[model samples]
Each structure stands twice: as C-alpha cells, then as structure tokens.
Target: MTQTWLITGASSGLGTALALAALRAGHKVLATARNPTKAAQENPQIEELGGIWISLDVTSPDTAKHVTDAITTAGGTIDVVVNNAGYSLLGSIEDMSENEIETQFSTNVYGPVRILKGILPFMRAQRSGTVVNISSSAGVDGAPSCAMYAGSKFAVEGMSESLSKELQPFGIRVILVEPGYFRTKFFAAFVAPAAGLTEDYVGTPVEAALKAIKAKDGSQEGDPVKAAQRILEVVTSRGLGAGTEGFLRVPLGQDCYNRFQTKIDTLQANLTKMKEIAHSTGFDS
Candidate 1:
C-alpha cells in the first residue's frame, strides 16, 4: 500500500534521502523545506520522482497552521509525518548565550511541537498515522560540548515517548529515530557555537570535543541512504509503525546502539544501587 508522506527539512541530508526513497517506492511525498524553490532546484530527483516541494520553516510561529492547511488543501490524509528539521549547537553550557540556546530550542524542540500540533488533529480524527521524530544519540546521553543540542534532543525524546502513549488509543504511532552520526550535510547546515569563550574553560574537554567534531565533520560512518531505507521499511511495515508497537526508539548506527546500551546499563546500575532507598522514600505507610 502506498502512503502519503510529509517530510520536513527535505532540502538535503536524511530528509531528502527519505523523500526520494518514499517517492521511488511509489508513495506520494510532500517534501517541505525552508526554501522550497532552492530545495527543488538542488534535488531535482525528488521532482523527477513526482514529489511535491512545499516551503516550511520549522521556526515560524505559523508553521502549524500552514502545515495543516497545506495537507488539507493537497486533498489526502498524511499517513507518515517525519520531523527531521534541526541543527546542532555545540558549546559548554556556561559559554552559551541565552539567545543561542533559545534559538536552538526554537528550531529543534518548539518547531516539532508546532508541527505536531498542526498535523496530529487529523491523525487523531482518522485514528491512524505514524510520526517519526528524528532525534540524536545525544538525546540518550549528553556528551561534553553538546549541552544545548542534547537538551533539545532530550526534550524531543521525552515528548515522543509521551506522545506515543497519548496516540496509541487512536492507532497513531510516534517513533523516535536516534542516529549517532550520519554522513549528511548536518554540520554544513549550521553549528551554533558560544559567542564568547571564557578563559577558565580553555583547553578543557569542551574544546577537545569541539575539535574532534570539526575533525570528523564529513567522515561520519552512518550512510543517510541506508538510514532512509531502514526508516521506510518500518513505516511501511504491516503492524505498528516500525514493528515498535511496544517500543518508542530506534537507534541507528553502531555508535548510537552502543550509546543506547551504555545508558541502559547506567540506569540499571543506578536502580540496583538505589532501589531500596527509592522505595522507602516513596511511602512510609
């Protein structure tokens, strides 16, 4: 069965790859980007595969309404919604400015909130749909120099988890895709750094982490095409979106899988250590 997919941030990277994959599979794709004209021009293959480009800036306040209206006007229920528009803000928490942090949250967190606000009503009304929130391995574990980016992704992870439960009754599935590092133009898209560097933190882990990311910018091991294919397989599956009826996350790449395991192990260790104390604090009756 062909599904109608609405993909945000479709100009490049995983978004573009997913859009093309859906189109090639005979599914109708609505590819949205901040600059639809530029996206269409750059990725002509999308149009060649009968994909439609729509302008959608995730940070815009009116994005929700625009998205809902666009899909309504297009005359079909959006079977799959992929929230893939976001950027990385690399810096120590102390070094980041208020505006810088808020800007990252606006694009990474609030934007998806608004998009879901716009599209979820239809999904609920129809009682069937799938939402894929593109998160990062940082969403599972925050690393040095990634405080702001990880915070935003963590918010996405939490929201998607809650949303999965909220939409389950309506037969809508919310899946969070956590990818470690893909060979995408993610770095090229944008990397917000701290405006002013404090002397106290120089030559620390923050600096080293930032340097490592810069060095590994284009050498990431994960392939976006394969990632897209994997996501497509899940979205088109017979059962709950991605065969994750009882789950919420899909960690992509070996790095992501390792990080996920590390987090789980850490949590188990903590629980083992504090289980008695935690239970005692909960109730004295």
Candidate 2:
C-alpha cells in the first residue's frame, strides 16, 4: 500500500534521506523545509523522485496552521508524519543564554507539538497514522555540554510515550527514534553558547566534550541512509521490522543501544536499592 509521508527538515540529514527512501518505496512524500527553494536546490533527487517540497519553519508560531494547509494541499490525508526538524545547542547550563535555550526547545520540542496539534485531528478521524519523532542518544543519557539538547530530547521522549497510549485506541502509533551520532551534518550544525566558553569551564568536562564532538563531526559511525531505510521499514513493517508490532521506541545505532542499556541497568539497580525507601513514602491503607 502506498502511503503519504510528511517529513520536516527535509533539506538535509536524516530527513532528506528518509524522504528519498520513502519515495523509492513508492510512497508520496511531502518534504518540508524552512526554505523550500534552497532545499530543492540542495536535494534535486527529491523532486526527481516525485517528492513535493513544502515551506515550513517549525519554530514559527504559525507552524500548526502551515502544517494544516500543507496537508490540505496534499489531498487531506497523511499516513506518516516525521518530526525531524531540530538542532542541538551545545554548552554548559550556565554558559547558555536564555534565548539559546528557548530557541533549542522551540525547534526540538515545540516543533513536534505544533505538528501534532495540526495532524492529530485528521489522523484521529481517519483512525490510522504513525508519528515518528526523531530523538537522540543524549535524550536517553545526558552528557557534558549537552544539557539543553538533552533536555529537549527528553521532553520529546516523555511526550511521545504519553501520546502513544493516548492514540492507541484511535489506531494511531507514536514512535520515538533515538539515533546516536549519525553521519549527518548534525554535528557540524550544532550551535555553541553565544557567550563562548567561560573560564569556569576552561578545563572542565564541557571543554572536553566540545573537543570530542568536533573530532567526531564527519566520522560518526552511524549511516543516515541505512537509518532512514530502517525507519521506513519499521513504519511499513517490512524488512527487519517485520512482525515487530506494538513497539513504541526504535533506538538506532550500536551507540544508542549501549546508552539505552546503561540507562535500563541503572534504573533497575536504583529501583531495587530504593524499594523500601520508595515504599515508605506511602501512607498505610
């Protein structure tokens, strides 16, 4: 069955890769970017493969309306919506300015919220759809110099979890894709603190993390093409995702798997250790 997919931030990275993958799989793609002209210029294959580029800036207050308009223009039915437009703001908590943090959340967190508000009505009425939110490994485990970025992704994870349950009865599926260090312009595009690294962070983990990130910019282990293909397969229940239904989260890359495992282990350990203490908070019934 051919489905229509609406993908944000399709100008580059995993968004562009997913658009191409879906197009090759015979699906109609509504690829959106902040600048469709430039996006088209950068990714001519999308147009060649029958993908339509729509202009959408997720950070804008009118994002929900724009999404609704785009859906209406695309024949009023959307099967898959990928909220993939986001960028990282890398810095220490104190180093980041208020505007920087707000911008990060606006793009990474609120962007998806607006998209959901626009598409939920249609999906509910249709009683079928998939919402794929692209999170990050940092979302599962925080790291130095990534407080703001991790916070944004954590918000995504939390919302997606609740949304999955909320939409289950409506036959709508929500998936959070937590990818780790994919070989995209993601690393290269990260914004640093506007105030620059303060002397307090000169020799701290923040500096080390920044250096490590720079070193890994173009040498990330994960492949965006393969990741995109996997996402498509998961949504359509083909390839590796065959027979895998009722899965809420898809953690991409070995790094992501490792991080998730670590988090699970830590949580289990804490639960066991604090069982009595946790129970003590409740009053006798």
Candidate 3:
C-alpha cells in the first residue's frame, strides 16, 4: 500500500531521518519546517529524493492550514501525519521566563494540536489514516531539569492516547512515539532559556541538570535512522493482524526501553498499595 506522509520538522534530526526513511520506503512525503533552507543543513541530497519541503512555523496558528495545503497540493489526502517538530525548553518551572514558557507550549503543545485539528478532517474523510506523534521519554517518566519540556510532551502523550480510542471507530489510528535521548541538535541548541538566574544559582540542582544535559546532548546511543526505520516498519512494512494494536506507544532506544521498564516496575510496586486506597478515597467507589 502506497501511503502519503506529511511530516513536520523534516529539516533535521528525527524529522529529516524519518523523511528519508519514508522516501526509501517508496512513500510520498510532504516535509515541512520552520525554514526549508535550514532543513537543507545536513541533507542537501533530500531535495533529489522527491521530498517536498515547505515553510512552516508551528508557533503560528495558521501554519497548520499551510501544511495541509502543501500536503494536498503535493498529492492528496495524507495517509500518515508525523508530528515530529518540537524542541525542549529545558528549565525548572520557576527558572523559566513568562515568554519562554509560552513559547514552549506554543511550539510543543499547541502547534501540534492545531496541526492535528487541520489534518483530522482529511483523515476522517479518508476513513483510514495514522497519526504518529513524537513525544519524549521525559514526557512519560519525567527527568531532572526538563520539567517544562516534559510537560509539553506529556500533553502530547495524553492527547494521542485519548484520541486513539476515539478514532478507533473511525479507522484513524493514533500512534504515540516516545523516544529517548538521541544525537540531535535539540538538546545542544538552546531554543528557549533556563531563565536568567544568578551565578550562585548556576550550581544549583536545576543548573546541574542543565550541565548534565549539555554533557549528554550528543552522547546518547539511539540512532535516529534506526528509529525512523522502525516507525515505517510498524506503520507500513509490517502488521500484526487485522484489528490488532501493533504498537500504541513505540518506545525507541535502550534508554526509552529501560525507562519504560522502570516505570512499569514502579507501577507494579504501587499497584497493591493503590488498591488499598482505591475504594476509600473515592466517593464514587
């Protein structure tokens, strides 16, 4: 089955990788970024690969309509929509400026939501489509010094999960991807600040987290190409069966897998204790 894909942030990192992978899979891709010229940074060869690049600033409310138009103009109804364009605004809740926090939600949360809002009409009309939203490990298990970033991703996860159930009857599948740290400019580039704190605050726990992030920005072992390949495999190359949930949440990388296990362990440990209060604390119960 040949599927057309509309991918956000296709200029670099996972977006670029996935865009290429989709192309390699013989799928049509409508790739978009804040700046198409900036997207040509690492992969100038992408231009020759039949990947259509379009200008898109997710922060803008009207950007999703532009994205939809690009996708429609390139071909037709988008079979798969990958919401992979997001950045981390690493900072503690208090350490973030007002505008910085707003920017974070604007890009990471609201942008994706509005984009989906624009595309859902098309997908619903098609009666069969998939939406793969790229959330982060920080979104699931939380991490030190990444509270704001994590919150944005958490919002994505929650929305995707609920939408999956809602769209099930409509034959529109929603897949949530939780990726661990990978070698991307995301952590290296400070798109948003950690707030302007005093020099004394530099060595504080929040600052330490920032320092740790700086050190690990490009050190993660996850391969973006491999992750992209896996995504395509799940969505296209392979299938479990008719009416089977192949992967509701695909956790890529060893870090993601391990963190998922750890979260499961914590949940299991608390399960018995949770039963004790389940009935007592709830008025409905």
Candidate 4:
C-alpha cells in the first residue's frame, strides 16, 4: 500500500535516513526542514529520490497550520507523521539558562504537540493514520548531564502514551521511538552546551558525563540507516519483530532494549514494595 509520510528535520541524520527509506519503500515523503533551500543544497538526494522538500521550523507558531494547509491544498492526507526534530543540552540542570530550558522543551516537546494538534483533524476525518514521535533512551532513564534533554523527551513520551489511548478509537496509532546513542549528528555538531555555566558544580558527575559524551560523539554504535529501515518495516505492518500497531513505545538499539528492560524491572520491584501501602491508602469504604 502506498502511504504519504510527513517527516520533520529531514535535512540530515535520522530524518533524512527515514525519508529516503520511506521513498525506497514506495511511499510518498514530505520532508521538512527549517530552511528548505539550504537543506536541499546540502542534501540533493532527498529531492532526487522524489521527496517533496518544504520549509518548516518546528518552533514557529505558524508551522503546523502551514503544513496542514499545504497538505489540504495539495488534496492529500498524511498517512504517517514523523516528529524527528530535536536537540540535546548537555550540562547540569542548574547550569541551564531559562531560555535554554524553554528552547529545549519548545523544540522537543511543544513542537510535536502542535504538529499533532494540527494534523489530528485530518487523521480523524480519514479515521486512519500513524504518528511517530522520535524520543530517546534518556526519556526512559535520565543520565547525568542530560536532565533537561531527558525531561523534554519524558514529556513527549508521557503525552504520546495518553494520545495513543485517545486516538485509538479513531484508528490513529501513536508510536514513541526511544533511540539510544546513534551514529548521527545529534551528538556531533548538533548537540549544544549549557549556556549558563555554574562554577560550583565544576567537578560534579554532570561535568564528567558531559566530557565523556563529547569524547564518544562519533563512535556511537547504532546505524541510522538500519534504524530507519526498521521503522518503515514496523509502520508498514510488515511485521519486523513485534508490529508497531500493538506497541506504544519502540526502543531502538540493543542498549535501549537493555535499559528499557531494566527500567521495567525496577518499576515492577518498586510496585511490589509499595503495593500494600498503596492499596491501603485507597480508603476504608
């Protein structure tokens, strides 16, 4: 079946990879970037591969409406929407400035929410669609020096979980993709440092973790191409492992899978430990 896939941040990295993969899989791709002209100049393969490149800044208030209008004007409905645009702020939470924190949330959290709000009406009308929110392993488990980034991703995950339920009746599927460290520019030139540095926390775990992350930037093991292919496989119901339909969250990479299991185990243990107390608090009816 031919599908129309709308992907954000398609200028590079996983976004580009996914766009190309979708194209190769016989799906129409609407690839968006902050600057379409610049993105095209940088990566002409997207256009060459039949992807329609559009200008889109996720942080812009007009972006969602513009995208919705464009699709409507073109007489098209998006079958799959991929929210893949985001960046990380590597530093202590205390070291982050107000603007930096808000920026992270604005791009990583609010941006996707706005996009979904704009697109849901169309999906509801059609009564079938899929939304894939690109999160991170940090969303499942916070890491040192990544409090703000992880918080933003966690927000996405929580929202996606509720949305999956809300849209289920309408036949719209919501998927949260939690990817571990991948061979992408996310950890290279794209990752930003804390704008406001706190001297008091110079020798803390946050500082050490930031240094380690910088050192390990380009050496990540996960391949973006493979990840993109796997996403397409799941979205298309080809059944690569568990189908995307029954799962709300898809943890990519072995590292992410391991961490996800660990988190599940920890949650189960905590629940057992607090079960009696929690049940007692329900009240003495």
Candidate 5:
C-alpha cells in the first residue's frame, strides 16, 4: 500500500536517499529542506525520482506550523515522518558556546519534537502512523568531538524509545535509525563552527576525529540508498510497526553495527554477572 511521507532534511545524504527510495517504493513524499530550491538543485535525483519539495528549516520556530500546513495543503495525513534533518556541530563541551549549543538543540532535537507535536493530532485522528527519527551511533556510543551532537542524538533516541511505547496502544510506531558515517554536505557551506571558539585543539582527539572524517568521507562503506531502502523495509514489516516484532534500535553501517554489538555484548555480560544479585533483590520469598 502506498502511503504519504513527510521527510525533513530531504535535501541531502540519508534524507535525500530516503526520499528517493520512498518515492520509488510508490509512496508520495513531502520532502522538506532549509531551501527547497537549492535542495532540488543540489540533488536532482530526488526530483527525477518524483518528490515534492517544501521549505523547512528545523531550527525555525514555525516548524510545527509549517509541517502542519504543508500536510493540510497536500490533502493527506502523514503516514510516516522521517526526522532526518540534523548536523554535527562538533566541538568540545568547554569549547562550544551557549548560542551554539542552543542552536544545535533547536534543530537537532527540538525541531523534530515539534514536528511530532504537530503531526500527532493528525496521526491520532487516523489512529495509525510511523515516525523514523534519523539518529546516530553517537546516540548510543560516543566518539571524541561529538559531545553536542551525541547529546542531541541521545535526546532523540530517548524520545523515540519511550514514544514507541507511549503510542503503542494507538498503533503508532517510532523507529530510530542510528547511522555512522556517509558522504553528505552536512559540513559544506551549510554549517560552521558555532563562533566564539578557536580551533586550537589541532593535534588532539578532536583534530584526529576531523582528519578521520575527511579521510573516509567519500569512501564510507555503507551506501545511503541501500540504507534508505532498509528503512522502508522495516517500516512495512507487518508486525514491527507496533514495536512488538523486534528491537527499537536499528544500527546501520559496519561502523555502527560493530559498535552497537560490542555495547550490547558488554551490557549482557555485565547483566549476567549481576544476575544473582539482581534476582536476590527481586524477591524475599
């Protein structure tokens, strides 16, 4: 069955790829970007694949209203919403400014949340929907120089996990796609260091991380289109939409897979070691 999708950040990378994939899957999509014209120009493939463009800056106070209006004007309730618009404002906690951090949160965290707020009433009226939050491995595992980004992702992950349960009775599902790295203009002229900070930590972990990112930029192992396809597959899986068929956290990319598996393994081992104590505290009988 074809459904309508409202995908934010559909201008590039995973968002753009997901937009194309969804369209190819026979779904109509309302793709949003900061500048819809530039987005369409930058990624002509999306237009070629048949996607309608809309203006959406995640940092805007009008996000909820904007999305609400777009959905209303399009004459369709959003069947799915992919909160894929976010960027890494990489900086040390001490190095980042209040304005920078707030700006990051506004887009990376609050924007999506507001979008959810706007769409919830519609989804509730329909009594069914899916929300895919484009999170990051940083949500679960942290690498150096990702303090702020991780915080934002972690915020998204926490909400998705809980909302998956909260909306379960309503037949709505929330999924988090934690992807590691891919070639995207997230760092292009579109973003910048949040001012008031000097990049003097050059030879340190942050610097090393930046070097590593550029080193592997275009050569990232995971294909964005394939990743987007996988998301659609998951979304359409019969029993998974209610969050009963499987896990809430779907880590994409070899980089993410390994890190997530390691974290889970370590957590399991720790739980096993504490099993006896945990059980002991559970029952006095």
Candidate 6:
C-alpha cells in the first residue's frame, strides 16, 4: 500500500535515510527542513528518489501552519508524521543558561506538539494515521551532562504515551522511537554550554561525559539507514514488525535495549522495596 510520509529534519541523518527509504518503497515523502534549498542541495538523492523537500523550522512558532499548508499541497491526506527535528544540549544543568534550556525545549518538546496539533485533526477526520516521535535512550535513563536533552525526550515519551491512548479510539497510532547512539552528525551538532565547563565540573562525571561523547561521535555502532528501514517496517507492519502492530515503543539498538531493561529492573526493585512504605501512605480505609 502506498502512503504519504511527512518527515521533519530531513536534511540529514535518520530523517534523510527515512525519506529515501520511503520513497524507494513507493511512498510519497514530504521531507521538511529549515531551508529546503540547502537541504535539497545537500541530499539530492531525496529528490532523485521522488521525495519533495519543504521549508519547516521546528523551532518556529509557525510550525503548525507550515505543516498544515504542506499537507494541503500534498493531496490533503497524510499517513505518517515523524517528528525528527531536535538537538541535544550537553552540559550540567547548572552550566546551561535559561536561553539554552528554553531553546532545547522549544525544538525538542514543543516542535512535536505543534506537529500533532496540525496533523491530528486531519487524522481524526480520516480515522487513520501514525505518529512517530524520534526520542532517545536517554529518555528512559538519564545520565550526567544530558539533563536537558533527556528531559526533552522524556517529555516526548510521556506525551506520546498519553497521546497513544487518547487517539486509539480515532485509530491513530503513536510510536516512540527510542534510539541509542547512531553514527550521525548528532554528536558533532550537539550544543554545549556557552560558558563551557565550569570549575565545579572539572574532573567530574560531566567532564567525563563530554569526553565520551566526543570519542563516540563517528564510531557509534548503530546505522541510520538500518534504523530508518526498521522504522518503515514497523510503521507499515511489514518485515521485522509484522504482526506487531500493538507495540507502542521501539528501542533501536543494543545500548538502548540494555538501558531500557536496566530501567525496568530498577523500577521493579524500587517498587518491591517500597511496597510497604507505599501501602503505609494510603489513608485509612
């Protein structure tokens, strides 16, 4: 079956891979970036594969309007929407400025919210659609120097979970793609604190985290093309995701799987350990 896919941040990385994959699969792709001219120039293969590029900056307040307009120009129906435009803010929470934090949330959290607002009405009217949110393993398990990024992804995770339930009656599916490190320009593009590392963070986990991120930039084990293919499979209910339509989240790498499992284990242990205390908190009944 052919479908129309709206993928944000399609200038590079996973977004570009997904656009190409969908186009090759006979789907119409509306790939969006802040500057479609630059994006097209950078990834001519998208156009070569029959994908169309549109201008859309997730940080802009006009995100909803722009997406809606694009959809209208693309034949009035959308099958899938992928919110993939986001950046990481790496630094201790104290080291980050208010502007930096706000910018992070604006792009990572609010961008998807705007997209949902624009797309949900149409999906509800049609009674069918899929919303894929590109989150991170850090969303499930936070680490030092990743507070802002993790917080933003965590917000997306929570929103998607609730949205899945809310849109179930309308036959809309929400999938959170919690990917681990993939070999992309993500690390290279990550925003660090303008002030740089503070003296308090010297020789601390924050410093070590920064070093590890720099070291892992191009060496990340996961492949964006593979990840994009998997996502397409899951969305289309073919290949690896056959007969798995009911799943809500797809963690894409060994590192992500390990982190998710560790978080689950920790939660279970905490619940068991705090059961009595939790019970004690209840009012007399």
Which one is best on lDDT? 2
Off by over 4 Å in 2: none
| TM-score for each predicted model, relative to the true structure | 0.94, 0.98, 0.91, 0.94, 0.87, 0.98
Winning model by TM-score: 6
Candidate 1, residues 96-206, lDDT tens digits: the string is: 888888989999999999999989999988999999999999999998888889999999999998999888999998889999889998865556454655677689988
Which portions of model 1 miss their true places by more than 4 Å? Answer: 238-243, 282-285
Candidate 5 or 6, higher lDDT?
6
Point out where model 3 deviates above 4 Å: 192-194, 198-204, 237-244, 282-285
Which prediction has more favorable TM-score, 2 or 5?
2
Determine which window of 10 residues in candidate 6 has minimal summed lDDT.
57-66
Task: Estimate the TM-score for candidate 1.
Answer: 0.94
Weakest 10 consecutive residues of candidate 4 by summed lDDT: 188-197
Error of 3 at 48 (Å): 0.7
Distance from true position, residue 233, model 6, in Å?
0.4
Off by over 4 Å in 6: none
Instruction: For residues 1-285, write the lDDT of model 6, one tens digit per residue.
Output: 899999999999999999999999999999999889999999999998889898888888888888889899989999999999999999988989999999999999999999888898889999999999999999899998999999999999999899999999999999999999999999999999998888989899989999999999999999999999999999999999898799999999999998889999999999999999988986798
Compute the lDDT of residue 221 as modeled in candidate 4: 90
lDDT of 3 by residue, 143-225 (tens): 76678888999999898889999988879988888898888887887554644655666677878887888888878788898
Model 3 residue 273 CA deviation in Å: 2.6
In Å, residue 159's CA in model 2 sits off its true spot by 0.1
Global Cα RMSD, each model: 1.9, 1.0, 2.5, 1.7, 3.5, 0.8
